[model samples]
Target: MRVVSLVPSLTEAIAVSAPGALAGVTDWCTHPAGLAGVVRIGGTKNPDTAAIAALRPDLVIANEEENRQPDLDALRAAGLQVLVTEIRTLDQAFAELDRVLAGCGVRSRPDWLDAAEAAWADVTPDGPPVTAVVPVWRRPWMVLGRDTFAGDLLARLGVRNLYAGHAERYPRIPLDELNAARPDLVVLPDEPYRFTRDDGPEAFPGAPAALVDGRHLTWYGPSLAEAPRSLARALRAARR
Candidate 1:
């Protein structure tokens, strides 16, 4: 079955499961590198519907949050089969993986999926929760807010998001307000915005900042297998 994957995590999962089945993928689908010759449809939020439909794919995989409704609607309007996924927690991540794989014609579960489940299954971090404001963007400072998969992932690592109860999923807050929160730490992810050693930490002089791999924290695919350990190391090194 021919498939076009708009979500980066789903792109990697499907590619890993059935290498050559992907006829098109979004430009941001960078994992499992060397996706040579794959047609680039555009970014997740603004996929080229015409280009996607032109590929004549039997199926297109998308996420409710990562993609826009109008784009998915246009694809459906053109008579294309679109599978939309929603993942807000680790359990939802696993279940969504199954749904995507099955939609893409992979009946058997991938070993990476099994490994990821095992990695997060018994995670019980010792200590009080580390309060953090995780910034995904720099300019104007957009942070991970309520009901986010990234926030949920951090919660598993004993890193509680300071803005997890905020109304917006991704909220833009003033730097002063974030600092005023007096969080124990500032968690910085490398994608959507690349927060480096010299870039994000200084803003929160009162707290240590942990620069982490956005893929591990945000993407729910093969990387899930190593996210617990990798995130743990970064959060640990951020200690004051």
Candidate 2:
């Protein structure tokens, strides 16, 4: 069946599990290294609906948070089936992956999915509980707030989010305000905004800053299998 995936994580999942089933994907679907031939349907926020419709795909995979409602509505209005997923926790991610695969007509679970489930099945947060502020973008500085998959992932690792109770999922707080909160650590991932060693840590001054893989911190796909360990190591190392 032909598919057009707007979510990067879903694109990687579909491309890896059901290869060749994807006829179109957003330009940002970069994982698995070589998705070169698929039709480029622009970025996640601005997918080319006309181009996606032209692909005549049997399914279009998206995420509620990553995609805009108007675009999904337009796609449905144009007679395309779109599967929009909501994942705020690891368990939700596993369940959603199963549903997405089933919608694509795959009856059996992929090994990566099983591995991912197994990876996080018995996690114990290793160290003392630490409070953190996770910045996703720099310009106009936005941070992870309230119920979010990334925050949940960190929570699983014993890192509590400082703004997890905030109403907005991603709130644009000024840099000075974030620094004033004086979290035990500042977790910086390299996507949504590329926070590097020199770029993000300096802003935090004396606060411990953990530079982490954005995919491990945010994306919910096969990478979930290794994320728990990968992020834990980074967070632990940054303490020293």
lDDT of each: 0.90, 0.90
Query: For model 2, what is the alpha-carbon lDDT of residue 120?
Result: 92
Q: Least lDDT summed over 10 consecutive residues: which range in candidate 1?
A: 197-206
lDDT, model 2: 0.90
lDDT by residue for model 2 over 1-240, one digit each (tens)? 999999998888888888888899888899888886789899999999999999999999999999999999999999999999999988899999999988887779999999998889878998799999898887788899998999999999999999999999999998778768888989999998889877655557778889999999999998999898999899988888
How many clashes in each structure? Answer: 0, 0
**What clash count does candidate 1 reach?**
0
Off by over 4 Å in 1: none
lDDT of candidate 1 over 103-165, digit per residue (tens):
899988899999999989878774678899898887788999999999998898898898999
State candidate 1's TM-score.
0.96
Residue 72 lDDT (model 2): 98
